[model samples]
Structure formats: C-alpha cells, structure tokens
Target: MSQDPSTEVVARELRGNILLVMINNPPVNALGVAVRCGIVAAIDAADADPAVQAVLIIGTGRNFIAGADIREFGKPPLPPSLPDVCNRIEACSKPVVAAIHGAALGGGLEIALAAHYRLAATDVKLGLPEVQLGLMPGAGGTQRTPRLIGAKAALDLMLSGRHMGAEEAHALGLVDRLGHSNDILADGLAYTQELLATHAPVRRTRDAQALSDRQANRASIEAVRAETGKKSRGLFSPLKIVEAVEAALDKSFDEGLRIERELFLQCLDSAQRAGLIHAFFAEREVLKAPETRNTKPRAIAHVGVVGGGTMGAGIAVAVLDAGLSVTMIERDEAALARGHAHIEKVYNGLIAKGRMTTDAKAANLARFVGSTSYDALAPADIVIEAVFEDMAVKQAVFAELDRVCKPGAVLATNTSYLDIDVIAASISRPADVVGLHFFSPANIMKLLEIVVPAKVSADVVATAFELAKKLHKVPVRAGVCDGFIGNRILAAYRMAADYMMEDGASPYQIDQAVRDFGYPMGPFQVSDLAGGDIGWATRKRKAATRDPRARYVQIADRICERGWFGQKTGRGYYLYPEGARTGTPDPEIEAIIDAERARAGITPRSFTNEEIMRRYMAAMINEGANVVHQRIALRPLDVDVTFLYGYGFPRHRGGPMKYADTLGLPKVLADIREFAKEDPLFWQPSPLLVELVERGANFDSLNKSE
Candidate 1:
C-alpha cells in the first residue's frame, strides 16, 4: 500500500471484473511482515476501485506461499499476526479467492481459509504442517478449517501436518476446485462473479462443523492421546496437538481459536519447537552447499554395483527402481543367482503388500543386469562398491574398479565405519572416490550419508550430492571418519546400552527404555537384527585397535559366539517365544551378563529407565561432539540430520544433539562429568562438549559456527 519494494502487491485488473493479486516474494513467496501489510493494503484498494468487483489472491512462482519464513517463527508474532491478516481478508466485502500453486502450507493455508472460495493448481499441495516443527496452525486454521471440513478431518490435518494434493483436497472438501493456475483463477473469479450477482458470497469454509457428536470429539481426543502417546512416546508435539483439537470440539469457534492460539504460543516458546525448526532448516540447507548446486554436473544414465551381497542387491534394486539401468557384479554366477533370488523375494513381498504392482516388479527386474564380469560397468555414470566390510578386500575391489571404470566415472564406497581415506589410497583418482553409505534396504530409508573425504575434489562432492538427489535420498555431506556420522554416534549409543546391561538392566529393559525414548527399536534388538556378528567384529576391531577404553560389555559377544546371532539366529537377545512375531529378551542373556559381571568382580547395580536413557543418550551426544571435534562432520546440524533422517531419532525431538540442547548443555555436561568420575574410561566427555559447557554455550551455538 505504501508502494515500497516490500509493501507493493503485484496486482492485475482482470477484465473490469476481478483483480488477480500476486504476492511477489522471490524463491518461496513467504508471508513476512511486508507481504502481510501489502495484502491488507490490497484489500483496501479492491474496495476503493470501481473496476475490481472481486479479488483473487495468488502467487507468482512455483508456490502460493510455502509458509511464513521459518526465520520469523519462534520470534514474537509480528503485530497483525497471520490470524489477524486472515480476519481482515475474511471481513472484506468483496468476494476473495485463493489461487494456490506449489505448497500452500502453515500460514499460507490459513490465508486461503480466509477466502470465501478457493481453487488450487493441479500439482500444488496444501497442508497445515506446523506440527512437524512442534507447533500447530496458529492463524485461525484450527477454527476455520474444521468449519470448512469436518472436525475429524481437521484433526488429522492439524495433528499429522501431512501434504495433500489439490485433487485429493477437492475430494475432501478442503478446496473448491482444482485446475491449472490460470484456470483455477478463472474458475474462482467466475464463482466470485456469481456471488456478486447474487448479492453475497454463499459458501464460506468457516461454517462447516468437523465432528458429529460432542462426546465423539472427546473420544477422538482420547484416541489420539493413546495413539500419539504410543507413537511419539517421548516427544511432546503430538500430545499438545491432541489437546488443541479437543479444544476445537469442546469450545465455541472463538473460544476454540483462543485455545489454539494459546497452544501455538506455548509451542513457539518451547525448546522443542526451536530445536525441530533448527533441524528442519538444516536439512534443507544440507543439499545446498556451493559445491553441490553451483557446479555443472553430468546426468546419471546408468549405474553399477560391484557386489551381490544383501547390501549390493538392495542398492541395485534402488537404482533400478529409480528407472536407471543397473548392472551388478558378483564373484561368480552362483552368487549372482543368489542375489537375484533375494531381489525376487523382496519384490514378491512388496507386491503382496500392494506397495508394488506386478508391472512395477517386472519393470524393475527387467532393468537389473546380474553378472560376474568387469565389463558390466562400461556405461555406468557412477559405481558404488557395496562389498564386504574388510579393508583389504575393499582395497582389492577398488583396485579392480580403478582399472575397469571410465576416466570420469564417480566411484563410491558404501562402507560403514571404515576409513574412506584408506579405501581411496588404492585408487588412481582419489578425487573421484567418495563414500555413499546407504542404510540397509537402501530404497526405503531416506538417509544417505555422503562421506566427502578431504581429498575428494569439489566436483566429486558435487556429483555425489547430485546423484543422491536423483536417487531421491537425503544427502548429508559428512567428513570422512570411522562410521561417518550415523554409525559413529550409534557405536557410542550402543556402548551405553551395553554398559547398562553390564549394570543390572536386561536386554528387554534396555529396549523398552530406548523405544520409550522415541527410537523405533532398542539397541539389543537392532544389534540382533543387524547381526550380532557385525557388532562382535566391530568390537574386536575397536578393541584390537585401542586398549579397553570403556566398560566393554562382553555379554553380546558371548551371545554371538554361541551362534545365538539375533532374529536371523532366532535366539540372540530374546527368544522367538514360539510362533510369536517378535522375540523377547532371553533369560540366558541376563544370566550371561550376571556371570560375566561376577567373573570380573563387577558389582551389578539397578538402573532406572531414566538413567538408561540418560547414559545411552550421553554416550551418543558425547560421540557426536567427538565427531564434530575430529572434523568427521560438517556441522552439529549434520549430526542432527544423520540421526533424524538416517538413524530414526524422533523428528519431534529433532535429533539427538538438538534434543541435548533441550536437555540443557550444561546438565548434559554435568552428567558426563559425573559418569567420568565414576569410570574415566567410557564416561569421558569430548573436548567440544567440555569447552561448550565451559563457555556456557549449547550445540545450537556450535551450529552457528557452520
């Protein structure tokens, strides 16, 4: 309205009947103070102009409004907050519509709710996704959306904050129509003209009630509390969301709105909100380094996997599923046949789950080439080595690949906890050697820890990131070290769990504690699932390399040695429990721990779940600090991303390091010091944590250094 750079709204008069208003913020058209002020002025202009009978608010580029800038959240809500802005829009006498495109999310959807009518572009998405950041929709979304859709529908939207396409949204009554951007505008304008001719806008989304019964809404609240309590467990956002939705059901529209606002404010001020938002922003920033985005990169037409083990087979399936032709090499035809059979078994199971159609399975299988020859990699743009986790064997594979691969082909090692520098030492083009550590079932998990050793050229790092994007995975640019980032922290965390077992906690008890803390599975169950043999080997390797630096629990080793490997062995931490789906903690494991503790003259003491969670987490956070201190990670946020996306740290808790911030860095430091005094071997704090605590700083502050 002031005609300033940020204040001016890009408006076009539409055929003397409608004014198409576009918010002109570049990149994502975020609803900032300037944009909100401009919109308020635009509504005033529309009322004053004789030619503009109707108004349609739209966006200029890929999205209508992705959301308010995250930078603006957690700060005080700017005066005339999003709710107030939407109220102004709703109060306008002229018919107003929202022509949404891209992602109309958070505050963006709240603005659209203010309009009397709505139309979204075909490909655009809509969601009230503040819950992901530990906040709910603050700007009247809780009030108006239930009025537009049902209370049940609104609860789902508010609680999960999941994205819905325009088509799905139309079916759900969240949108009035779905079409192309211009078509959506035309439809919205025509609808507005009909309203004008009829004397007033007829359909306001604010009047639709969500749930049928008062008791039913209360029941819904109870249901969500149980669900989120089990699902989120340690996290706080979902439970708060349940309360906000209950407010919607129990109170009047204005009263419900007041409650929603109160809850949103509470969450905004909470450390969880700040932590989750930090992680949210850091994840988007990970793929946006100068080396990844600024350089010219080649397209990946073909890929090669130089192994036929479970890891290699999974990697090949992911590549083929991404519509890239893949050739997998094995030691012989028998191994190739075995790997191909494994792939078939996985695909068949997927088809059974309705996740993959027969046609999709056929296509993916068709794209896979299984062979035992070096010539299979002739056309590969990139080659990933998913061989065994042995240094000498990996060196041999790389030596062979060096002779086989094209001059510029990107070569990567999918090694967990191995030295990438040592792997590259055998290669001619060390610049081209990067580590692409994919978690098992590479196609399913989103985390791809991209290890960029110091010797890796900027272009190679860029190419690794570009390839990760093509594979549709989260690429974390981790510096080279043992286990990179995810497994490195995992190593320490598991050590804590083992330490607990050595003290009085049983395997099931530790599992219960971890799952209670929001991890999907407990460490012992995970170790069993990951093969008890793997942990046994890593322990021996670390033990052989260094003196017993920690209170090493030898119980898991005994289980492995007994060939009670895990779920695969069906007798590791817990027994199969006879025809039961999952195993329970073996009495034998407890007995084993007792025997080991007695043998070492160790006094076994009881540990509460809180202490188990504390020590387990302390080990992880301390290890994360060590990782950062050793330059094995790019930033503290990188450690967060590694855990959140890659290692199943609850998104609501953000990541382990972010969660530590909520726990207070000084408190965590104190706990570590207490443990160090108890046993200086395993409980010693990393220098980074010690310095941060000495400086009265947090991991959030360390993230700033990046």
Candidate 2:
C-alpha cells in the first residue's frame, strides 16, 4: 500500500523473478491523475529492479481502473497518457501480463492492450466505449486493437461500442487465457513464472509482420466510408475513427499512433465532444446544487404512494424494487384492488420471463402493502403524490400530506410541468416539497430528474442525490421553473414543430424530418402518443395563470378541439383503422392548415425535409441556451440528458444539444435569426446563444466556465 490514501498503488517483488503491481485506489479504483502518476512511477520501479524478470499488473478491488476520471475530461488531459504507459510497458525487456478480473474499459482496456499478454477472470467484460462519450480512444486504441484483433473486428468493436465477457473475449483473441483466482497472489505469480520460463521474448503487437490475410479490399473501405456517411451524417468523429483505422492499416506502428493522436485531437476540437462532455457533466453536477441541500429529510425506508393510475402503479413498483416498503394508498376499494392487481400482474410477468425467480418475485411483492386510508400513512417516512397534473388538486393533496404525514416526512409531487416552488408553497413545510420526475416505465428508464424549489434546503438536495444512487438511477438536479429544464426546452421545440406545420410543412413530413435527423419520433407524433389533450390541459393551465407570451402552442389546441385525440381515442394525426396504434396523417388537417394560413394571409411555400430538420434542431438549441441562461439546468449536459433519456434522442447522435455543437454556433445563430424574421416572438435568438456565437464558441467552452 502507498504511504498516503490519496496516492495508493500496491507493489511488491515476488520470488526475485516476479514483480506484482496492483492498483489499490479505493471506491471504484478511479484512475485519477495521482493514480496515473503512481502507475508510471511503479513501472519505473519495476524496470530498475534487476531481480524482476516479469511483472504482473492487476487491480486489488472489484476491477482495474474503470476508466479515466471522467471529471478530468475537458479540464486539460493529464501527462503520461495511457498509450505512453502502454508503450513503456511493452518496451520493457521483462514480459508484462495484465490480470483483468472485472471491467477493463477505456483507459483500462488501453492498459491491458499495452501488456504483452492478458489473462482474464471468467466473469470479466471488456471494451473501448469512448465513442459513446464522443471520444475515440486517444491512447493507441485505434492502432493496437487492430494489431491484436483484425481490422474488421476492431472497427466493429470501436464503432458498435459493444462489450464482451471473458469467454467471448478469449474466443475473439483479446484475452490470452481465462481463469478464476484460486489464490490471489499465487495465481498471478504462477502465470508470471510460466511466462518467464517460456523466454518468448514478448512480441510487441505493433511489430506483427503481416495481417496473415491481405490488406482491406477496395470494396471493404468503400463500404466503411458509406456506413460512416450514413451514421455520422452531420458529425465528424465516428467517420474519423474509420480514417484512423485506415491509417493503422497503411502506416507503421509509430506512424499509426501519430495518426491516432491527430484524429483524437481533431475529435477533441469538435462540438460533438463539447456537447457530449456538457451532457456528461450535467448528469453529475445536478446532484448537489443549492436547491435542496438544507432540507431535513425523513428516513426513507417506508413510502406511502397515493394514486393507482399508470403513474401510481409504476411509482409503487419502483419504490418496492428499491427495497423500500410501499403502502400504496388509493381512493376507494376498486382503485385499491386494481392497483394491487396491476402490481401483481407486473411481478408475475417478470416471473414468467426468466428474469426473476418465482420466490424472488413473491418476496418483492411482499414488500408492497395496499390500503385505502391516509391514517396509516401519517407515520410513514415519505408520501409521494403521483396524482393527475392539476394544480388546485395537487395543492389539495399537498395540504393533505402536510396534515396527515409525520414531521420531517418528505412531501413529493410527481408533476411533469408544474412549478415545484408553487407546489411547495401550498404546504407549511415548503422545503419538504420537491419534484421527483421519473420517466414512464420508471424501472426501465434510467433518468430520475430531481427538481428543487427556490427555498429548498441543502440536505434535501444531498438526500435526493444519495437516494438516486441507492435506486441505481442517474439523478440530475434541476432548479425551480416552469417544467424545470427538460420540458421547458421541449416547450419551445415542440411549439416550433407546430409553427412549422402551419408554415407549409405536413405533420408526417415534420415527423419524418425529425426521425431522419435522429430523434426517435417527430414532435407531432410524440404529442399524439403522449396525447394531444395533455398538451391542451397544460396550455389551458398556462393560459389561466401566466402571461399570454409564456411560451405556449395553440395549433395542437385547435386539433384537440376537433376531437383528434391521439392513440387511446384511435384517431390523431392519421386515422387509426380498427385496432392500429399509430395513425396516418388526416388529409382534413392539411385543409385546416391551409385555411389557417389563408385566413392569416400568410404565404405558404413548400419546404424540403432538410430545412424542416435544421429549423427544428435550431429551435431546440436556442431553447437549451435560454434554459442555461435562466440557470434552470446547471449545464449543457443536463439538458442533453433530459432530452436523451426522457425524449428518446438517438444515443449515437449524442442527444440534440450535443449534436448542435457539430452544426457550429455561428451557423445556428444565422438560422435562428432567419427564423426570427418569420416569427419575432418565437424565433428570437437567445442572448446566451448570441454571445456563444459571437465568441466563436460551442457549449463545451461555456461549460468549462461553469
């Protein structure tokens, strides 16, 4: 063990021929800057010792360095890059072996590749997932991986970002051997001794004479270019990965790494990386901003859930799965019984699948207790009001929870768009009221947006973040505002879609445009699936309470007025014959759009799908800038996470806001200003965006300041 906790690296000389090196950093063994330095120093120590004939590198805890400390990303990369470390390791005369047990990701995988040989524990999984985070592996991954695994295999691994288990890795020739630890030091020592005896003269993978096959065929390179052309349509980096691979195949080892670094630097300069890094930081930052840090929290072991609707049932199921005892409270016998039956059916379905054993299913269900009274809930640790989204009714529920619940009990409301501060004002203990916005099918979706009202205590924020960790969900902190960050950004973008509809674009055309741009669905289709009436209800609420210019959409209201309700009503954008869910666009709506355009004496010109996509994305980025200016969301990544997880953003495209970085700020501002000429109030460029554009910056540069 090292002399200090801050810098810990396990080291020992074994039997005069084996040098055992282990990373002993506690808590996930994060490869922080200090750990990196320690590792470099350890390698120096191993090299200087004449007694050391072989070195074994392994991690002490669950696994090796999970990845580089993501916190350090964008904040100037540390010296002694993983590739440099790997180069030093391989160039050593003594054979180096990597003992990988759990995960060897990003830098971890890079380190393993640096070693002359690698042995794996049977359950370990490995991969290079930097592409997912808008990064290609910087440390010789593009070069060395292809050297070990062929070009085709390496390209798929880099592009698809799929991970493999130990056995699969062995089958693919990534791992030299797979075994369990019979005796910790003994196993690694034994492996090292066997390697030392072979005198195999550690073959540097970079020195391989040939592919043992031929170079990539012409058709293969063309196919890769075409695939990248489609996949990274607007972005520059994924295709750049293909370029790096091509360089790897054509150049010498040193030459290939130089090409890899060149490509890596190019990606580092990209807006996609900036946007993605923004999103990555936002998810982490939201956990402890001052919104709910001081509020006294109740012990959340037991929760009383009110409402038995879809939201209620889902909340109940999630709370139970989190190992909290749930007393599901409903209005009457029918609702109570229905809620119980629904929870049972969900658990039963899980049992039917091989996912959950019958015994485990029963045990999980036993944690749930359904009742029809507020009397028993008064003593519960928490009471969550997952009722319908009506302010007066929600206020009444808050009043009831305030009256019925014990002191210090957390009073939460699961309202998607209502102001959490206003909901908190309804109760005397306003600090106790916070927003817990769980996406539908809560257990399946990983995002849990925790919104803090203006007067919320710091302790509450910490508790919420901690609770998110316990639930195994990513908790993003949001400040009090209408719809918080996610929906507020959507409000502007969704409204833009409606305006585009009136401005000579069809609903189907807009939907197709968005889907082509990489969103899972178009705004209109989402409105239909989410139900037009809900938008109508939210609009009516805004109309009654807020200013006329409080960012509202009315075209959908007119559609709802005609009873063109989505899905459940079986007639929405398109007609749903008999039992179909998604309907075709109704021709009548085109007539309504035409009539509205003529009534307003507006010129309607045909727009190509390209213009529609550019406008929609521009609107979303504009709103994201507005939200950041308003300080509703901490950073750009928070907005990215909001859209990516909540709104079904194409993961590979890296969410809308991050995707915008690829479009460049100046171009987006130009487009927004052009749109503003058409609709002054709606299309006015965000001041934040104007400044960013003026500064020739992307979201990433601004985020560094945050």
User: Which candidate should be chosen as best, given lDDT against the real structure?
Assistant: 1
lDDT of 1 by residue, 343-421 (tens): 8888898989999999988988888887798777877888999988889989998888888889888889999988999
lDDT of 1 at 289: 55
Where does the lowest 10-residue lDDT sum fall in candidate 2? 209-218
- Local accuracy by lDDT, each model: 0.81, 0.77
Which residue runs of candidate 1 sit more than 4 Å off their true CA positions? Answer: 1-6, 9-15, 48-51, 180-184, 194-202, 209-222, 288-293, 548-551, 578-581
Clashing pairs in 1: 147-208, 150-210, 151-210, 151-211, 417-483, 574-584, 574-586
| TM-score for each candidate, following the candidate numbering | 0.93, 0.82
lDDT value, residue 279 of candidate 2 = 60
**Model 2 deviation from the true structure expressed as Cα RMSD, one decimal place:** 4.9
**Candidate 2 residues 399-434, lDDT tens each?**
878888888787778889888888888789987777
